[model samples]
Target: MRPAGKQPLQSLYFDYPLFEFRQPPELHGGDMQHPVVIAGAGPVGLTAALALAQQGVASVVVEKKDTVNDGSRAICVSRHSFETLQQLGAVAAFLDKALGWTRGRCYYRDQLIHRLEMPHSEDERFLPMYNIQQQYIEQFLIDKTADYPDLIELRWQSEVSELKNSADGVSLGINTPEGSYSLRGNYLLAADGARSTVRELLGLRLQGDNLPGNYVIADVRMAHEFPTERRSFFESSGNPDATVLVHRQPDNIWRVDWQILPGDDPDDAVRENNVRERVAAILAMIGHEGEWELEWWSIYTANTLCLDNYRHGRVLFIGDSGHIVPIFGVRGLNNGIADAVNAAWKLACVLKRLAPASLLDSYSPERRGATIDVLRNAGKSSRFMTPPTRGYALMRKAVLELALTQEFTRPFADPRQVQPYNYEDSPLTTPEAGAGEFTSGPAPGAPLHNCRLDEDDYLLDHIGHSFTVLYFSIEARPSSELAALFAQLYQLDPACCILRITGAADQVNEDDVLVDASGRISRAYDAIAGTVYLVRPDRYVAGRWKSANPEEILAALRRALGGSKP
Candidate 1:
């Protein structure tokens, strides 16, 4: 089936659009600089550009490739990612074509041993995971960039050859199809892949361990009736002594990842006949005897590598350029998207002079902390999926064998799906006044839980791309003094949204307020009269309070913005 928002120009599961590369003006005239220059046009870079545009920040995105990604790489999209996409105005395009699923099953020796169900409720707008090709993800983000033509300039087939950075700005030597040109920007964000050219130019190296185990991910087309759910197999008859993962994608394509044993040659694993034999064994073992054709396949190794620092001078590294995590937990693309959002918002605030330049310093710490956390958890999953030593292998085998009969051992088979990182230790997070009092709501540095307002409307729909204040008003309208306080906060930052949640629909007629008629949102946020939550631009709660004190809220906002002068 063709993806939404684009016409099919090719005959495969999706169309690959070849973007045209235009001549640069620097070839014939003087150099031109941009507010921000982004390297690479992959999903991460494009998402950064879109996120920047959401804040009215302009950027120039350069890509070495002329078309989208070649294969169905990085097919899993997390709900937190969907929330970021919604802020960038590109979620509808994704929801149109991506397959959503919440359930996963694990099998050991062809026997079902464990099941995984990510947290989901009717109040949530998106599912736990969505399966779609990376090409579609890139194309959808590219399509959204068209809406901000004046802000985003996409340069295709233009690669970064030389780079120089200083405290003031960054300069790059860009090589295009026509010739070479020099460009400048106040800041450079590197969203390029793991083998980033910018990272190399900056002489930064990724520091981490590359866990042992080689897996070949292959996508095949067939008319299988299996539902869209993640399924993992351990020590199955298909491969005898390997771990395999199966995921159903759109357009009737199935993605199968089977491990290659230690003595197996990585090159020979992708041979047509070898792949066919292994795939046939896997399909037969899973009771799928239908005819299938191989579409694409690639070799992947589990690694947890990242840079010590994400920022160098005026150049900031994001996505894979900043860190690389194990693929076992589907943290690659999702983590990159998170990096893009985090960097874009902070950079935008700095550029707009809304916050001090020190705000950018927090990027490396927050994101690097997240990377370290992923490495820790994914290291466990990687070792579990592919035991490195003989003793570990034996332990894993015993766990699987015992898991078939013991209920407690069954949890050992769980993959421990990826979850959003809490930035409680972040410098921007303000300690709550009565933090110990609230037991149910999102704490400082945690993401707000979405609440369903109606069948179609959700809490996230009301969130904006700025600091938001969720004020709970018990009366029909806030006191005159509290109303004056809201006006004062608005005067501090016009972009700031002070959304008053009233208990009754007729309490307020202002468009800036939300009516919690059903009290679902109140319960979700654990709100009472005068309770206030200060939400950052990235949707993470910065601070919350039981009483809506004006000075405390102002201090929290300033602290969240790097203590900038009001």
Candidate 2:
């Protein structure tokens, strides 16, 4: 076998199984089988599996958990992720149980200081943010993939004990109930979560710091006389200082979280009497004397950490396995799910021999950059939730006070701060020089945008199957040669779409807009006349030119398609 540090292909193929030349049933006239093995069965893992399945790539998912956890961990699904779910054919199931939330209020000292409503339409690419449990999300994905033969096989109760990667592929030692078995695949994905055993086996370390505080979360049912439409944030007024976040579930149950006291024992914090007292205290603060019934309560520490590397050879990490941020911004789960979507299609391309092995390197730089931003936002939100110093407290109060006015609320209402993070310097991004002030050009290492192309249309449907070449020109028609070449390429491969623009266009404006879905075309592509942009499947700019040159554009396409240099 080749040494571990060598390039992926040499190492992977050095000691992998050799396939015999034979005709197979699935490949009646083909010669190769799809190659990808994913670890874990969580939302991230399932998302990766479903994305691959949607692309006709065969994969397998192994999970240690036997069944889904009936917990209310993740609640808010962002507009971008909502669009992704729709693509996976799981949006309908999620909408069935999700509660649409269009407004949020921030309270300081029992006074409503800021209230903002979402600026969105019902028929937009994605609806306003929805509040749904993670369990339901997983169930929907699992049900959606039930009939896809090309999809993954859910190996419940299967845990991966060890993983080894070489130049050609990956081999995993999975510990099953029956016995330990070795499985091989072209690439292995580690969506196994924060305490991932797969990450440890690969000798990769999670690099980041844990915050200096913790919070207590409880799932309880309360019969109260409060507005069910509004989510309540209550500041502490009693001993054992706390802030309570209360919101109603679709099942008529209330999800409540009480910020824990410093140096409090979590095990003892959830005792029957302690939970009762906490509920009673919250009720009293809200001026209600109703019956508060406790269902489940747990104390958790809100720690923020990120992995130094998301890829270790053929085994790539995604989701909590790569990064863990505080729950204040509700981005941890969302970030993980987004990572799955990013890595899934890329892995499929590599396995299908459509993209080069070096493409995997882009995964870490892209997702980690986004995760770092998530941590930063979560840190900021945590400070707002639990300000550390007097100065910070004063600033928080001022922002809230300003939010009370319409003039100040308009900026804060955008919620762009909590949107998906952008990638700024990834290797996958092509350099765009001398193209200024246009939105359609590519940024070398930037993350995708989270907003829709337009108010009425969704960006997800437009970007499907292959890379997109968005040409924005003020000229009446596209360059004939460029248009013909793109049309020929699309006719040869219907998986891609080449859209031409001139003068008046809807959805995007000039700027650096490159993302999988929901990005401003004008922002990234420089909506200037006669400009052509080449976007990759994951929605990053691969290359761009002032005007279309078929030869130069074809070379860039060849590079993106994993072809060797001329």
Candidate 3:
């Protein structure tokens, strides 16, 4: 195990910066109090800090390590994750550095049997997936936090020794390079990874089963002409009776994984020479004749473990600390990103006194429900990729065999990719209107569809860090009642936004209105005259109506805020 110290870890293709750890004011008895103190300076923790900062909340992030993680772990980022990053003002660097792709190919016995194409449209701002190393992910998030120095304080080599929870707040005993000190936070966010110290100290345990089969994941640097697409091989000559997955990443670093046969010695699977031989065979099978050097390697098994609840009084768990999803659908990091965003926004509302404390009670249900959904889909992929029983193994073989001759069976090879989890059942979501009220659009608790408004503008681009209302008007000018409703909305919450969409191009001169000259945005949202959609701060639709009344809109807003008393 790596020791807890300020030593900068080495990476083959990435430079590691030695972050300086300064003594905290608490060590000098200065009695510093943080609004939110985040544990574990990983991608999720840093993302939570950034998301909080975006909501005008301050946080202090503590880490036991000195720099970014060593290996290229969690290399896949989904488009939904990029949208979260966009809200935090940190998507530019990622968009510039990550390799985006949407195509995947699956082969049975070296013969291509299935091709997977993820959903992509011209209205979308990002592709389906982006391949970037985790080290770069952490570093990019850290760099983005620099824009909010007052809001985010990163402390390296600081480890939590003890935690005390109270109704008022949380007291954390932190050990640093200098010495041990204590800090108080109104709330603590545990973004720690699989082996969570907070969960242990709190005497909480994750509940679920760890699936079977171990796979050796390795990264190699080589000059290859492969495009950035996923390739899966089943029963290949390189690794018979097992599955092999390959992905092309930036910096000429390719990630490869092959399952370890049941009878094979798991220890020998990762041995330097054995890994080299296996990688060489796989490369040859893929028709690559170029030389490659091993960078890093590790072993992992599929697991669907998760905590029953994410909130523990003052400490709210996010990321792997709360749940660990299988990597088959690339839901691990992407789901963590979603958790951070969801919790951060609700925490911000509570801290700013915009909503009651009960507002946070909905976090566990929404995110944990999403985790459960991931487990269901990922379990299927896991069983197919690495069968735990002979029955499952035979079933997989039969499916592969049938897929070779039967075109209709090819769909069985599909690795169901991750999708944005809908919070339709969330307590915070206002009940939607009757099903037939609207023909097409995002239902309550669904994420807003990104629609193109012009050559350079999209619907989500106009969103700010607050509750949003989209009002579709048939008249070139809003009626007096609608104007009064807008006034009432501002009076209720000045931070709330009322975006008026009109077909009249000349009416676009208004600051709060968007001109649907092409009607594409309207069509995408299924917006008709007098249609109203209320969106939460996290971009999920809170409620929608065919014709909205001021009282109904205010009531829905209050309900979305956990039925807070106005």
Name the runs in model 2 displaced over 4 angstroms.
Answer: 1-34, 117-123, 222-234, 238-240, 287-292, 387-417, 431-433, 437-459, 471-480, 487-494, 500-533, 540-552, 555-566
Model 1 residue 253 CA deviation (Å) reads: 0.9
Give the top-scoring candidate (lDDT). Answer: 3
User: What is every candidate's alpha-carbon RMSD to the true fold?
Assistant: 3.2, 10.4, 2.5
Spell out the clash pairs found in candidate 1: none
- What tens-digit string does per-residue lDDT give for candidate 1 at 1-566? 12233243443576678899988676677777788999999999999999899889999999999999888889999999999999778999999999999999999989999988888999899999999989899999999999999999999999999998987899999898899989899999999898999999998899989889999998888888878999999989887889999999888989999999988999899776788889999999988877887777788888889999998878889899988888977888988988888889889888988888898888889989989999999999999998999988999999899999888888777887778989899999988776477878899999988899887888888998888999898675678877787777676566888788878787556777788899998898888889999998889999998878888888888788888533
Q: Which window of 10 residues has the lowest lDDT sum in candidate 3? A: 1-10
Comparison by lDDT, 1 against 2, better one: 1
- Model 2 residue 344 lDDT score: 80
List ranges where model 3 is wrong by over 4 Å. 1-8, 474-480, 491-493, 564-566
Clashes of each: 0, 43, 0
Sequence-dependent TM-score of model 2: 0.79
